[model samples]
Target chain A: MNGIGAAMRDAAEGVDVRAGFTGDVLRGGRRRQVRRRNGIALALAAVVGVLGFGAGMAMRDVPPVSDERLLAATKGDLADDREVLLTATVAWRAELTPSWTRDRGVTELRGEPHVYWASTTPVGDAAVVMQEGKVREQWRTLVGLVARDPADGFPKVVGTTNPEDPTAGTESFQFGPGDRTFLVVDPGIPVYASPNATRNPAGVVRRTWHEVPVVDGVGVWTAPDGVAPSTVRLVTSIGPPISDIPAERLLTTRPASAYLRSGVHAKRNGAPAYDTRMWNNTSRKQLRVGPDGPAPSPDSDLFQALEDAHMTDIGPPGNTGTWCVYGTSGTGGGLLVGEYADGDEPSTLFALLFRADGTLDRVQRGPAVDFGSPLPVRVRLPDGQGWVVASSQYLGIAYRTSDPGDWQEAQTGSQAALLPDAAVQVRVGSGTGEVVVDLPR
Target chain B: MAVHAAEEDFEEFVVLRSQSLLRTAFLLCGGDRGAAEDLLQEVLERMFVRWRRIKGPPEPYARAALANASANRWRRRSRKPEADWELAGTPSVCGHEEQVVDQDAVLRALAELPPKMRAVLVLRYFDDLTELQTAAALGCGVGTVKSQTSRGLARMRELVVEVTR
Candidate 1:
């Protein structure tokens, strides 16, 4: 057996092979199935309730209910009906989508529409109006009606209106003219017209519209052309968007200055760099880098040198860089090398030679390499020593030392060298600078 | 009656194969017996739900579910640590006594690898599945399995050397 396979087999030898399970697996399984079935059933029931409530609101008239009355009705006697409100709000929002009225010849509106009011009339008719933001990229006022569903519980969009135009201010077919209860929602904040607003096929023009804040929150209702004044009703309440936090703030929390680096320090240092490689030949008990250099142990002072050279912490999110370590055979110490770069900034390379005594031998920062050409940087060090090459253009490459046949191919990004005694070499493209260190055995 | 018969057959399969399946789970959970039991029970419950529809043997599906669940849990629990790449403090060499190659030391080393890599090792070694079978179980291509095996074994070797040194 191979060394790894044999080692793993030996390790698993003492693990308890007996399955001493006392819990009832069958009962547990059956209980889980029951829970799943219950969840699906509950979801379907809620959908039906919402649909029934919407249909009732459209067909009948409820007593003129104030905001407090509506909230109290929905909350029932529960102390915490916030979850119910949120769920109902989500279902109402789902019904505001364009597809909700796609078959009715209404296009789905862009931007999230907040549902401010949803209630059933005393006689069981359902009525809801969703305040949508600017339409067609124009800062024009648009409101959508959540019409009663023809079949399923999903709300259909019976119609939408441009509130600014008296000729197009209201859609009358869905709701009959009567003494119906009205829930007036005026988002006191100013609304702007979209700069690129275009007219829809329904002949509603997108015009710039904004509302001046009124003290009583009441506004005059401009009935659609030919509608009787007695049938038109107006109510007013200042209801801001549900949450105070901006949508953009919730989506991205990255700091503005996180990637800020001083312009003066960002320039690349023109230096010759080389693509380098390293490997340990298990049969020969020798560590080799390129054609001759030996692999370094982890306790060497090279770590200190890299730190002194200011080339540490050069991996990932902050910079496109990679740091990798491979265990050396015979010695318990590891071989560590890292390379990192910021765009247009000088790339730095660091390497450390570690001994069994916990002391590190740091490699001095080598001469800078000229950019543009793929320069070759080679270091011939004695056994138990190492080096690093860095450049602005160091093409991040990784090599597998465990498989001899796989050494020719390179893996992108930085990778760990896992084989302690496999012959391997890595070719690193040097674009900025290279550092080399040789520790005395 | 037919449904009852199917449930009985499923129960029989669990009774006969639970020991071997638990061994695979134990290794996958880094040798934690409790976590292994929980993972095994969850896998069995899911398998029981679709027992009738499952064609062929159920072992592969169970193993695949175990791997996916372990990986998802690891992702959810671990926040990205700061990108500090430097090895902190002095690097200690393992004591020479550990060079004797203890089984516990090897298992501990195996436990330290990432979940996907560990799963690959357990599936390939403990389950004794081939590259093709491992790929099918993991819902990935054979090339991914090959690369993961190579990388996993390499990392395992490194840990072993550190422990044994």
Candidate 2:
């Protein structure tokens, strides 16, 4: 009669044990054992077939195809210029079963083969539905470098054209080093460009405009050479313009008072749009992000990172998002913040700062408060830095920056304008409060 | 004839021990009666397949199989323990009100523990197995059993405090 043992014994009492359960167990066990045996027999049969075929192959005449030739033939037109980045084939079947309500429960069932062809190009990717080796539906579009699938080893395309009517189009694709190239295809679609105000030092382009092609279905434009990718503020618009006038002008022409506002317009697709919504919501609510002290859970991502570094029991109890912040001194670290839970109860908000070597620098805890729909908080720290703080009622904030070493907390109740240099884009009111930043080019 | 003899022996073992085994299964499943029954059935079936070779007492083998099966089910389903225990419903806190409440808290805490840790506690306490016996049953060393018990009890104590608060 000890602590946990006694409690466990008391808890184990009063469980009802049913009769005749043994027969059920015996039946189920025999079924599983039989299935396993059958599976092994099938595998052995397959091995025998392979071995027999290998021995008989020398007596027969069969043409051998080299891997190079097979790959070359598969890569029809783009074989010479672009390497085979990745190829994926999808096979499907559509079945229809006709059932009658009057006489028969089911009458007939039919199925047809469905296949699709997709390839990722060096410039852009194309996906087309093929029927008898003919492209039935094709959509080719320019994708942003950020949207690329890391597994594909090539940049993935962003928007897709109406597949039923395969349109040939040319749009801008940003390659390395702010190199802008207009991708021209056979069938073209409308393209619009929004100039970046931060990068355009002269502030030359105040408005977004539709670029009329020099030639039909073809357009070429380069970033006024030497603009860095970070400084370049161009986003290609493949779909119809959101407004009658271009979006860039709409964003730039807004009053400074409105620019100082914290919230953005909620879009039709639930995305936060800067120009569409009036910045009306400004209620500064504080949420508990982590425990009062350092108590990292073994299951949390921060703990896993610490464990990977062979440093245990160093941080908070809950996993919060972190991003690398770089400084001019080439020194940087990660800023992590979130709510800490002890078992099912979340008690406090915590912000942990880690040094360049993945060691703890400083930790701060805020009072626990019930969080409402997370509104984007744009804070300007005391040292003239800006950050867009987004909170996940469960996971905490997604704070990311390029140079984090010099970051310092702003005075309580600081306005948004004083910390203007750092612009972290976040979608507010979204349950997760996701951070929207460009992928590093 | 041998198959018949083995089947008879397994049936007799079940008739004699199923009640006690079911109680252990019930605790292993965090008071989930349906899950306990299913777990018991699976363990029995596994035992049935190898019953002829099972010499001496079958209780240890049965207990080990029950622990391992519960662990495997948790792994395969990846179901949250909190939700599972909630579905099991709160036990009636009528007769020995305070003791019953404490036991309920202990059950909930046990449910939240990792599978291996939970199994160690179940075998060591609910089944009244010695540390050495628990180690042999779980196929681990005595040190592992010791550490698991320590960690499991500490987490349970923390969870009890949290629930009470």
Candidate 3:
């Protein structure tokens, strides 16, 4: 095999030798003119630096202002500690459920507001709910039912599809932040305040004002201690608040300055904006502030797909900056995969590989997924091609594939689609298949 | 002021990097060497104009310029016809090996790759770029570079099997 590889390399080397022949012809004409011009430019730069230094000495400098005077001029009356509801843009919003820790008599139930973004698009009003640190379970927004059938090795929390009565059985479901996480809230009844009190349809979600007086579609809440208001941050495609949020307590978090400068695109509805690659700038402080890592182990196939495509970045030029890598093992067809970059850890973005005949074959991930053990959450591409899941906690790979009803688990120990034989099947047909569309993943 | 470099040095750079550039051009053109060469030359010429902007080792900048140009060209060509008849005259392998079989099959396989996947393979395996280097060339996150590379490699494997078999 090595000999065969070397032969291929040798064959390729021959092509290089051949290209060398014509390359000289292409360069012969352009070289002379460039040399003469460069010779003159270097001399000019030296003279300009000498002149500029002389000119600088002739300028006057003003004295710096004193700190005391600056403080005196900017003094105000009182400190404002008002808590405002942080309405994360669609990009950073997630339904977080607190973990249930058993104790003596009183069960300390903490509802965490999981706020990681997903590359996968929701079908018929689906919302991903986070419970355990790495467990990204999908919840139908209205009824809060897991979408995956229990028979499948991994059952996902899917949204309801009842158009007529989306909220038929969800009247008693509490809609406040945290199932054990900290969220900012006012000390009031987390009651339903929609114009119509009637139960919403299965998939429809009607916002209920947890706090009474609604000021600008937001209300103050003294969140559960675990779900602190300060921890309740929002993620934007543009990243951090360019300006301050309307509330005083909610200071706009700054993402890695390098990330902002690097120019990752902020995606809206999974579409890249005009001059950006993928929107993934999260503040390092925010990522560090959270007790858990990324809630949903994003689909590994998506990551693998991206990696195989040469979309993964190695560390900075000389390891001078942070380097994050993610990967995936298998995939289904329906995914809206792109790229994202928070200043902290790097996310592994993945996309599916299509056969020459347009059939979905595999998914790719960069080095990101290998960093964690395995993730419990699995992803179903928008096309319903296959399913990919991962979990560092699992003894082996933690995902299953197939249509909604019947899914098969991936082999243990293999968490990435490193070879050709590792392709997983995504059964797309009548039942759950019709719901998934063949969109870009 | 206009910029220039010694003829010898310029030739050296071109000789050293031309094959890599050609491979990238190949992928960008859906495996058309002639079109890729044309694209590579256009970039090299532009680099000649602003060679001063490339202060450090010129290879990275040249690669960036070529990648950018290739991507732009791919986007532009996609809007036009499938391929130009003139482009058909371009050669696939520079060598004339009587033993080489299924040359057309290789071309067909190259054409089958997705635009992004094809670009990565061209930059990585064909152009001999490291993962990070490819990512920088593509202006995407490292994660994206990994995913795209995996996808490209997988597709290439399957296509190779299909074509060779």
Top candidate, metric lDDT: 2
Q: Candidates' lDDT values, in order?
A: 0.43, 0.44, 0.36
> If chain B of candidate 3 is superposed on the true chain B, what is its TM-score?
0.75
Q: What digit string (tens of lDDT, one per residue) describes model 2 on residues A245-300?
A: 33232111111112112111211111113321112233322222221333223223
For model 3, what is the error of residue A209's alpha carbon versus the real structure, in angstroms, after optimal superposition? 99
Fraction of true contacts retained by every candidate, in order, equals 0.39, 0.64, 0.06
lDDT for each residue of candidate 3 in B107-162, tens digit (9 for 90 to 100): 45556666666667666765678889888878887899899877766776687577
DockQ of each: 0.14, 0.24, 0.04
Q: Is candidate 1 or candidate 3 better by DockQ?
A: 1
In angstroms, the error of model 3 at A199 is 99
**Model 3 Cα lDDT, one tens digit per residue, A1-441:** 112223233333333434354444444334433344444534544565667754123223322322122112111111110010012111111211111111011122122222121111121111222222211222222212221222332222322112123222121111122211111112123321221111132111122223223222122223345432222232211222322222222212111121122311211111112322222221210111111222222333443343333332221111111212223323412222333332223433444444434345544432332232223123333343343333222322322232343343334343221212223432122343221212113
Poorly placed runs, candidate 1 (over 4 Å):
A1-6, A14-22, A47-441, B79-101
Candidate 1 lDDT tens digits, A74-121? 212221233333333344443333322332233323333333334443
- Residues B1-165 of candidate 2 have per-residue lDDT tens digits of 244455667878887888789878877877677888889988888787678788768998999989988988888877555345555536533448788778778778777778889899999987889999999998999999999998887888898887656
TM-score of chain A of each: 0.20, 0.22, 0.20
**lDDT tens digits, residue span B1-165, model 1:** 244466668877888778777767766766565666788888888888788888788888888878777666556655742112121111122334443245555556666778788888888887888999989888888999999999988887787678667
Candidate 2 regions with alpha-carbon error over 4 angstroms:
A1-3, A37-441, B92-94
